[model samples]
Target: MTQTKKTAKILRCPSCGMLVQPKDEDFPFCSDRCRKIDLGKWAMGVYKISSPVLDPDVLEDLDGLRDGQSRDSDEQ
Candidate 1:
């Protein structure tokens, strides 16, 4: 009988779609640069949740907050 060694798990980088190993410092991403780019996209609102708002009360609260902020800015 023969035994075979297992290979490390591989994943694609979210920013550049490059293959990465689980053992890497940036496990899922290819490098530090790619990781930072992904963060930048999130900070810049390039990515957003694709689901509808199920709670009407939460939506109303968010609208109220927006209105309050605009009024405060106008007063300033």
Candidate 2:
């Protein structure tokens, strides 16, 4: 018996929940625009992966040491 051709796999578009077939050049996205949109999403939250190593709050003490504090100041 012979079987009809079938797509290797089906993938959902990350941008817009559309079904896509493996043979598609943009396998995860139905169109190139959708793929670009997915990339943009990743670009936006890239900060989490590269947050500043030293927070400004940690350096606040340095400024205080340089400038004498006044009694009215909030320093403890």
Best by TM-score: 1
**Which regions in candidate 2 have their CA more than 4 angstroms from the true location?**
1-10, 46-76
Model 2, 18-43: lDDT tens digits are 99886888876899999888788788
lDDT for position 66 in model 1: 97
Clashes (candidate 2): 0
lDDT of 2 at 30: 94
Worst 10 residues of 2 by lDDT: 46-55
Shift in Å, residue 18, candidate 1 = 1.2
Top candidate when judged by lDDT against the true structure: 1
TM-score of 1: 0.56
**What is the TM-score of each predicted model, taking all chains together?**
0.56, 0.46
lDDT by residue for model 1 (1-76), tens: 8999998656799889898887889868899999999899999999998998779999999999999999999999
- Model 2 TM: 0.46
